[model samples]
Target chain A: MAELIFTEDPEDPRLDDFRDLSTADRRPDRPGGRGLVIAEGTVVVERMLASRYPVRALLGVERRVRDLDLSGVDAPAYVTSAETMASVVGFHLNRGVLAVADRPAPPVVSEIIAGAQVLAVLEGVGDHENLGSIFRNASALGVDGVLLGPGCSDPLYRRSVRVSMGHVLRVPFAPLDGWPEGLNLLRESGFTVAALTPRPGSVPLRGLREKVGERVALMLGAEGPGLTAEAITAADLAVRIEMVAGVDSLNVATAAAVAFHEVAATR
Target chain B: MAELIFTEDPEDPRLDDFRDLSTADRRPDRPGGRGLVIAEGTVVVERMLASRYPVRALLGVERRVRDLDLSGVDAPAYVTSAETMASVVGFHLNRGVLAVADRPAPPVVSEIIAGAQVLAVLEGVGDHENLGSIFRNASALGVDGVLLGPGCSDPLYRRSVRVSMGHVLRVPFAPLDGWPEGLNLLRESGFTVAALTPRPGSVPLRGLREKVGERVALMLGAEGPGLTAEAITAADLAVRIEMVAGVDSLNVATAAAVAFHEVAATR
Candidate 1:
């Protein structure tokens, strides 16, 4: 069971990890940045406990702390009054519970490509919410893993974790070392890397499964100004979600979900 | 041409529709509700100008006002400095432009159903962003119209309009009356009312296109606690997006996009 430590002091040093969360948990790679993975609310907290990330600590109200099934949770869980907790954290958090975990080593890119039947390759997906939604979609739709290309935000950022419903922790993701050339790794591994672009000469999203085999590394870019020209050229082929004339392109995350469904669905 | 009357004062009664927009555009039916349809940013403003809603006035910086193709716009375009715009809006309106339009009489639900080939019937999807995203997806994926069932937020809400990239202005939506009984109107209109749920015995969404004909009314509920049991029971058949075990359900908007694409795809 996780150790339950009750604290009333707002200035307690032990509660430092949960402090000033709004901006503090933003850039995990920056200086003075505590690179801890933070999970908020009970649903996400439970998912954190179940993830591969090592649990560091937990802070929550008495009821919330007690409500969690903390069996084998080695870390300390601090139970505090909401007011004291708010004073420590710099703002009121209505989620009632929070958990912080140390990020595990990133999975190897080659390994993700090796084991994946269907993979989502993302480039320029810097928006935390969009990145998180992609992870959630990847998880639910049976995408084996995600390969993070350049300009992708850190998936372990607190907001991304929350927005992903903690699926960011569950989905295996690794940064692809090279740029457009890095896409060759999937091709070499018997994966058909198809870039999702709206450019002319690209194939429509439908009937893509008929063209490609079982292994697919589906590449997606940010919402506006989709995949760079070089990235599109590097992929095996370009695919697009056909839409009506004059409508704005789908949001990147929603587009990812639609494409992921098409890739995962049994036709 | 839109009359670009420059204003220095923030207290101009002409800007009332644009004031305190964070709360003003909410609950258009409530007491003290101005009930004006508001669109933020230049893209949505242009969409509003081309929509059925009557453009009442515009509040924007000079560059943004000049950038719009305002030919034939009968409404007054109030040009103002950023400082004055911020003061009048009760916040820093970063989008550089804002347009408010008087909502025309809502299209009849039967009329939307009659003209529709594919429609989305939303129940308990009260989140403004999600509702807007659904509209955007519906427009792009060729879902002809939207039927707002119980617990749905107003698609004309300012946040929905902005999130929808002004597509809400383009796609027709109408309120579905009489709860579950209202669903019969769709069935009578030759729309196969398919309730999207995760319940057992539900047909998977993968091959849904093979079964359903041209017209489909895809019903979706909010994120958690999906469609009410009564709503599911009332539909012609239940459909589910198959997922990996133990994963959370897809976001309401994301799921709608997946389903819409399936319905719209040329197989």
Candidate 2:
């Protein structure tokens, strides 16, 4: 079980990990200059406890901490007044609870591809909210894992964690280095890479399930400039959600959800 | 063509309609204490110029105003520097354009329903962003119109206009008065009112496409507390998106997109 510590001072040294979260995504001391994994609200905090990321500590109101089932947790959980937490964090957090976690060693791409029936490979999904939404869709639709290509934001970022409803922790993700070249690995693993684009030449999304039912590594890009030319070339086939003419393309996350449902439904 | 009149003063009374947008949604002068239809960004501004809403005025940078194909537009198109625009609106205008339009008389609920093939009926979707996204999805998926049930936010609000990518201007919408009682009017119009719920007893969404073709009206509620008991009971059928176990429901707009795609596919 976790140990509960009470603190009143906002400047307490032990609370440094939970400080100034608005700019927490950039950490000078960290290897990649990225912040520690942060889980907010009770639901996300519960997910963090179940994830592989090592929990560093927790800070929350008394009621929130008492609500958590702390068995097997070895970290110190701090109980602080809401005002003190707001003072320490530099913002008023209404989530009432938060958990700070250390980043774990990333899973191997091969491991994710090996066990997956359906996978979502994202490229240029730089927006944290979009990346988070994709992970949420990927989790709910039974996409086995996610392969993050270049230009993708950190799924463990606090905003991403919150937007994803903490599913980023529950879903296994591994970075796929080397841009389009890394996509070759999935093809070799008996996976058919289906690149999602609204291009005229691409097959409709509904038809994709019939074309590649064995295994699919569904690729998606950011909303505006969709899958890069080279990325499209890497995929086995290009698929698009057939949409009305003249209307703006669907939001990247919403489009991914629609496509994910189509692919997952038949599988 | 739009005549661009340059303005240097931030306190110009002519720009009051575009001032302090954060609080502009509530207007004491307008009916129901709601603000005039406001559009932000060049795309949405152009859409407003083409909509039925009477253009009141426009505030934008020179480049943004020049980009709009404003032929036949009679509104005062004020050209201002970004700094002046920021001072007037209480924030930096990243998109560098704004347009205010008088709210047009909404179509009658029966009129909106009479000519519609596929329609979205929303209840308790009070979030401006979600409301806008639904409009965007409905337009792209070829839904003929939208019926605002109880507790829906105004789609003409600025945030909704921006989030909808201006599609709210093109698609028609009207309020469905008298709660679930008005739902009977939909059945009278030869419509299959399908309520979207995650309830265990609800039929899967895919099956509903085959069951109700051509004239289907999909009803959706807000994210957490889904369709109310009264609303679900009013529908012809309750349909559900088959999500993986243990995961909470998708965002309201996202679930709407999935339902939209299903209906579109059938059409």
Candidate 3:
């Protein structure tokens, strides 16, 4: 069972993992970055506890800690006053509870691809919120896995985790090592690599389900600057959502959902 | 042509519509509310200019104003320094331009229904960003109009306008007056009134396109408390996006896109 330790001091050294969280939990390669996987609120904390990531500790008000089913949790949970919790975290988190976990090594890219019927391949989706939303959409739509290409942000980023409603913790993701050339690997594995773009000559997403064979990979890019030319060329075919002329393309995550519904939902 | 007038003072009475914007332009029914339509940044401001709403004035840096093709604009465009604009708006204006328009009387709900092949009917979707995203998706996926039901926030609120990328100015929407009973009006007008919910006995969205006949109205509610029992019962049929079991439902906007792409994209 998880250990419940009551503490009143805000500056305790044992609580360092929970201090100044806005900066402390940034990408580990950056300065002052511990790279801890931080989960906020009851739902996300529960998700972190269930994920493969190792739990380091938890910080929350007494009531919040008590509400959680900590019988299976092995880490120490520090219960403190809300005011002290806010002071230590450098922000007033109304969610009232937080969990920090150590990120395990990411799964091999090929392994994620091997087990998937449908995959969402992302390029240049650097916005944290968009990255998170993609995961949430991927999970709901039955996309088996996500493959992050170059320029994609970390799905485990705090903002991404919050925006994804903690689905980022649930979905399996791995970084594809090669760039546009890596797309060839999908074709060799009997997957149809379909790049999503608005450029002329792209097939309308309608009826696309019938055209692609069994396995499908929906490749998408950032919103404004869509999939690069080389990426499109590497794909077996290009697909696009029919839209009103002169209107901007749909947000990448929204576009992914539409594509997922069309090609991946049934599989 | 828009008259470009230079202004140096931050407290000019002419700028009152843009003052303390975070609170000033709330729904007119609220206390201290003027309920003016506000558009931020060059793109949204340009959309406001082309919209039916009467443009009151514009406050922007000189360079941004110069970049706009203001050949037919009738309003006076006020050119101001960023510092003065910040003081007037109560925050930094990073988008570099702003436009305020008077809210014209909304179109009758019947007119929007009469014209649209596909319509999105919303209930209790009060979050501005989600509301804005729904509009953006509706426009891109060929949803003809939107019918607002009870508990919905004003889509013309500043944040919704910004997040919609000004698509809110283009898409026609009107309030549905008679609650669940008002849904009967849609059935009379040839809309299927398919309520989107995950409850048991709901049809899978996968082939819903074939079952709904010609016109379709996708009724959606807020993210957490989805369509009410009364609302779902009023619909001709309950439909749901096929989702992975044990996963949370898709965000209302994302779900709307999936439905729109299925039923409306072709039409």
Q: Indicate which candidate wins on TM-score.
A: 2
The lowest-lDDT stretch of 10 consecutive residues in candidate 3 chain B is B25-34
Worst lDDT 10-window in candidate 2 chain B: B205-214
If ranked by DockQ, best first, what sequence of candidates would result?
A: 3, 1, 2
Q: Evaluate model 1: give its TM-score.
A: 0.96
Ranking by TM-score: 2, 3, 1
lDDT of each: 0.89, 0.90, 0.89
lDDT of 3 by residue, A96-130 (tens): 99999887888888888898899999999999999
Error of 3 at A151 (Å): 0.8
Instruction: State interface RMSD in Å for all models.
Output: 1.4, 1.9, 0.9
**Weakest lDDT window of 10 consecutive positions for candidate 2 chain A:** A205-214
Estimate how well candidate 3 is docked, as a DockQ score.
Answer: 0.87
Off by over 4 Å in 3: A27-34, B27-33
DockQ of the candidate models in sequence: 0.75, 0.65, 0.87
Q: B1-267 in candidate 3: lDDT tens per residue?
A: 999999989989888888898896555674446478999998898888888889989889999989888898898899999999999999998999999888887899889988988899999999999999999888888899999999999899888999999989989999999999999888998989999999999999888888977899999999999999999999999998889888888988888888888888868
User: Comparing 2 and 3 by DockQ, which wins?
Assistant: 3
Candidate 1 chain A, poorest ten consecutive residues by summed lDDT: A25-34
Could you tell me every candidate's TM-score relative to the true structure? 0.96, 0.97, 0.97
